[model samples]
Structure formats: C-alpha cells, structure tokens
Target: MSLLDLDHDQRKELAERVRQDYEELKSKDLQLNLTRGKPSSEQLDISQRLLELPGTEDFKDADGTDVRNYGNLKGIRDIREIWSELLGVRYDELIAGDASSLNMMFDLVMYAHTFGTQDSERPWNQEEKVRWICPVPGYDRHFTITEKLGYEMLSVPWLDEGPDMDAVREAVKDPQVKGMWLVPTFANPSGHTVSQDVARQLAEMETAAPDFRIVWDNAYAVHTLTEEFPEVIDIVTLAREAGNPNRFWHMTSTSKITFAGSGVAFLNTSTENIDWYASYAGARGIGPNKINQLAHARFFGDADGVRQVMRKHASLLAPKFNRVLEILEAELGEYDVARWTTPSGGYFISLDVIDGTAARVVELAKGAGIALTEAGSSFPLHKDPNDRNIRLAPTLPPVAELEEAVRGVATCVLLAAVEKLGA
Candidate 1:
C-alpha cells in the first residue's frame, strides 16, 4: 500500500520501524559506495591486451606515418576510422586525441569563447550575456564545464525521447543562447536516447544565435547493457542538410572502451567547423598522443571489434543494473515513495525519491554509511529545485556491495518519506 494511505498512528508505527532499521544499518559499520560510474576492474581486464598494443616497432600508421613523431594535429587516421565507422562520420572528419572527451569539450568551448565559431559575429566572451540550454537530470561534469565558463545554464526537461524540443526551440530564439550540451546516446544519469525525429528537429530548428553549437557528447554511444546497440544518429549530416552545417561539435572517447586513463578521444564536425577547431587547437599543441591513438586503433581493428568488446561489457554490466532494479522494485514498490529509470544502457540509474526528500534521503543514506551521487547532481548549478532526484551508479560496485548500498538507499527513502508525513 502507498504510504499516503496510512493513518497517523500507523504512519508513526512505520516510521519507528524504519528508523530502527536505519539505526541498525549505522551500527553495522557498512561502507558501500554508488557514487561515480567508473568501469570495474573486470571490465578493464577485458581489454588488457591493449597494454602491449602497437608495440615498440609497430608505431606507424598504414600510411607509413610514424606515430611517435609530433605532427598529425588531426591524429592518426587508423584511430579516427575506428570511431568514424561506429559513429557514422567520415574518417577525415573525425579527429582523434587524448583520453578524455571532457577535455575535448572544454577545448572546443574555450576555442569559441576566445575566438568564436565558424558563424559567430563576435567571440562568445564579448557577448552581452551568454546562456546555454542544459537538460536537467544530466551529467554533472557537463554542467561543471558550463558553470565554470560563466554560461547561464538554462534547464530543459530531459525526457525519454530527449530534451523537450519545444522548450529548446523557444530558448534558442534568443541569440545569447550560444550553445547546448547533449549526451545524445544513453545520456548520463537518465539513460535516455534522442530519437531520430528529435535529432532531425534539433538539426532543422532555427536558432537566433548564428554560431549556436550543440556539444553532442555521445559518451555512451556504445556503452550498452543489452544485446542491441542503439542507433548512432548521423547528427552531422542532419545539421548540414538543415543548412546548419556548423551546428554540432560532436565528441566521443574510448576511455571506457579501453584504458580509462589512456584512450583516444575524437571530434567530428563540418569542414568549416573542423578547420576552425584545428586553427585554435594548433596554437596550443603540436599534435595529440599519436602512439596512444595507434595502440587504440590496433586494439580495435575495426568498428565491429569495438562492438565485440562492448558486448562483453554488457554481459558484466547488465547484471549489476538488473540487481539494482530488482532491489528497488522489492524495497520501494509498495510505498510509491520513488520511481526510477530502467535504462538498457548508460552508467547510471536516475532515482527520484519523494518530493522535497531527495536531499534527506542522501543525508540519511550517508549516515548509514551508504554513499550516493549528491542530491541535485543532475541539474544546472547542482541544484534540484524539488529535491527529488538522485543518480545511482551500479557499474563501479560489486554485486554484493551494490545490493547493500541500494537497500540502504531504500531505507533512507522510506524513512525520509515517512518522517515528512509523520511530522
């Protein structure tokens, strides 16, 4: 039965029972964490062969370009081809670089901030006021980037289909809305995918900002928890067909695919935009780490090789996600105190506790030695106005520990909900 149906005395009885459980949890001295969505050791081990890849003598691309030397600002073609086929971009258009896609994003934004994009009338820093459309229940790190750069991050509903297009369309009518961040495939906390219809709409829509850009961060483009991989939208083509050739600054990385610490990152865009990025990027460095790029290319001979490995990842990850869902269903099913996403792919399970109680739930879980992604982490400025959403990372923890942490989270949710009522 829903907790709302309980009378005051019944509610009091329940609260005491839950509180007792919470106190007992604290006494157990548990130390379980579900905070960051990091790949497990086993997942990392799957690609262990990468450590010996592109060995000392094999440091040159098929084109006979020595990777050890510093000069392919566009990176080695072999690595670019791997992701290019997977993400559906042309080989020459995809530029490979260091491990972190986030860094690539930062550099892209910094470039525009300082010098403006292909169609910019003036640099973003010189604009009277700059705003960015950020979908709520998004990656915190994405929000961190914009906040650091002083962009007034506007909230758009991140729905099952994708960001609410009507809202996005309305928001972009203002030219000051320079750009937006999108995790198009299996988005960070929500595990949502942008439908082709939505993709087309976003591409075709008119924006007041001549140089408006979409930071299409397809971080989980291949990070699935199921057999079927979601479609990798041809966003670059979509925008170009829409006459917004410079619309998206597409990015992806092999950080999770190979070594998290050292994998290749990529950026794909129109000819004009790619050249613009190269000009700004060239002044900063002679070239990216081509040796690492070469190693990654050899590790995954082709796009199918990348797919074969992700299937292994899905095998290991699916179970943890399933266990988390099972526990959430069993523990919180009756109370109607919360609801969460059942994502087929992506690193997080976005949980929403009772309204005005998410922060309380996190606090309660922490007291019981359970760590969760901070409350409001999936929003602009790290503030969930209703205090209802919490992001759970099931990938990092072992199954046994994940269960403990999630169960504890359920207890906290229950206690927080009842306390809000009992008072």
Candidate 2:
C-alpha cells in the first residue's frame, strides 16, 4: 500500500523499519556520486582522436588561414559553416570561440551590464533593478548567473509545452524585466524541449522592455540520448518576423559532443547583435583559440560527421538513463508517492517525490554515502518552494555504480515518505 494509504500505526512501523535499513546502508561506506552530469571515462575516450587532430603537417583551415595564428574574431569560416548546418542558422552568422558556453553567456551579461546592447537605452547595471524570467525545475547554473550579476529572477512555471507562456507574457509587462533564459532542447535537470509553437510565442510576445532579450542557451540542441531527435523552430526568423530582429542570442557548445572542457562554443543571432558583440569582444581579446576550432572541424569534418558522433554518444548514454528508469519503476512504481520523467533526450531524470520529502531523501542518501544533486538545485536561488523535486544525474557513474546509487535513492525516497506520513 502507498504510504498515504497506510494507517498511523502502519506508517510508524514502516518508518522504524526504513530507518533501520537506512542505518545499515550508512555502514557500507559506499562513495558513489550522482551529483553532476559529467561524461564517463568511456564517453571521453570516444573523442581521443581530437587531442591529436590537425596533426603536425595540416594546420590550415579551408581558406588556408593558418589556425595557429592569433586572429579570426568571428572564428574560422569552415568551422562556422559546420555548426551553422546543425544549428539551422546561416554559416557566416555564427561566432565560434571559447571552450565553455557558460563563459560566453557571462561575457554577454557583463557586456549588457557595462555597455548595453544595441537596443538598450542604458546599461543594465545602471537600471534600478533588472529582472529575468526563470523557468523553475530548471538549470541551476543559469540561475546562478543571474543571481551573481544582481539580476532579480522572477520564477515562471515550466510546463510540458515549455515555460508557461501565459505567465511569461504577463511577467514581461514590467519594464525592468530585461529578458529570460531559454534552454530550448533537452533542458538541464528537466528534459522538457520547447516546441516550435512555444518558441514562436516567446520570440513574438509583447514586452514592456523594448530591448528584451532571450538568452537562448541551446546547450543540448544536439545532445540527444535517443534515436528520435526533435528540432525546434528558428527563433531568429520568428523574432525578425515579429519585428524584433535582435530579440534573442543563441548559444551552444560541443562540450558533450567532443571533449567537455576542450570543446568549441558558439553564439548566433542577428547580424546587428553579431556586430555589437564583435565590437565589444574585439576590445576583450584579439580572437578565440582558432587552433581548437580547427581541431574540432577536423575531428567532425562536416555536419553529418557531428550527427554520427552524437549517435555514438546516445548509444553510451541511453542505457544508463534506461537503467535509472527501470530501477525507479521496480522500486517505487506502486508507491504512488513519487513520479519521474522518462526523457527522450537529456543527461538527467527529474524526480518528484512526496511533497516535503525531497530534502529528507537527499539527506538520507548522503548519510548512506551516495551523493546526489542537492535538493532544490534545479530551481532559482537553490530553493524548491515545494521541497519535492530531485534531479538525478545518471551520466557520470558507471552502470554498476549507478544501479546501487539509484537503489539507494529509491530507499531514501521510500523512507522519507514513510517518515512524513508517520508524522
């Protein structure tokens, strides 16, 4: 029977039994971790050729520009060409550089703070208070950026369709609400993909802030862990059609596609924003690491090559995700005390345990020597108001370790539920 279905005596008895089991688990001293969505050693090994790419003899790009040199602010055209096809934007429009998309995102926010975008009348930092719409049960790193930069984050409900568009439409009526972050495909923590209709609405929605921007961090556009890859509408096209040519800045990276830290990052948007970014970036540095760009270009060779590489990634990743789902089903399926997403593509499984039990479950897991993504990590300010959501990252651990880690989580979930029901 479900925890809620049991009588007070039964719940109390169950809680005691669960507590004993949890104590026994703690004695094992297991050091398994599911804290981050880092790639496994096997995953990293797949891209080993990248380390020795563009071998000694060949260092020139398609245009014969010596990649070893220090200039090509817009990135090498050949590399841009390759990403453009995958991103569905024009080849010349992409600005390729930086190993981390997060770094590029920070620079954009800093630039907006210091100098403002083309449409902004004044710098963001100068404003009394700048706010951005945050889709909850979302990426923690995205929220951290806004928080660190002093941006007031307005939490919006992330629906199956995407962030609640009606709420987003209403939230933007306030003039100080500068913009919002968009993780369009296989979003972090929750694997909700933004449908084309939602993408169009976000691009065209009326806003009080004339320079409202969509920090489109399409980090997982190509990181599908399934055979069925879903594509999103072109935001740039939709924004321009809606008379807001510069409404969004699209950022993506090959961090998971190739080497996580040693991969190429990209930013694409309107020609106007591209020029604005280039002018500011030119002042920041001469150019990006073109050698890295060349290496990636050589490693993939073309867009199709990139797709083939991702398929290989899916092969390795899908099984781990399936294992987590299977364990949750076997252990907690009949409890009626928990629910989790069966994502088609993404690095995580977003789990929602009984209300007010998520934190306790995480605590129990930690005591048992299994490290999980801290409760509330998927929300803004590291706070899940409901205290019910837990993000399960299955990518970092080996299959054998993941099985144990997930079972431990299931045990914690059951224990916490019983304890809460007992009370």
Candidate whose TM-score is highest: 1
Give me the runs in candidate 1 sitting further than 4 Å from their true place. Answer: none
- Report the CA-based lDDT of candidate 2 relative to the real structure: 0.88
Residue-wise lDDT of candidate 2 within 1-423, one digit each (tens)? 676787878777877877787888888899999999898999998899998987998889889899889888989987899999877887756889879999998888889888988889999989999999999888899899999988989989889979999899999999999989878888887898998889888888889998888898898888888776678457787888889888888999999888899888998888999899999999999999888899999989998899898899999999999999999999888778899998888788899999898999999999899998889998888889999999999998899999999988998999998777654
Q: Which ten residues in a row have the lowest lDDT in candidate 1?
A: 88-97
Over 1-423, each residue of candidate 1 has an lDDT whose tens digit, in order, gives 889988888888888899899999999898999999899999999999988988977988978998888898988888787788898887767888888889999999998998888788999999989999998889899999899989899999998799999899999999999999999988989899999999999999999999999999998999989999989998999999999889998898988887788888888888888899899889999999998888888888999999999999999999999999999999999888899999999899999888899999999888889988889999999899899999999998889988888999999999999888853
Model 1 vs truth, CA RMSD: 0.9
Q: Let me know the TM-score candidate 2 reaches against the reference structure.
A: 0.98
Question: lDDT per model, in order?
Answer: 0.90, 0.88
How close to the true structure is residue 337 of candidate 2, measured as C-alpha lDDT?
A: 84
**TM-score of candidate 1 relative to the true fold:** 0.99
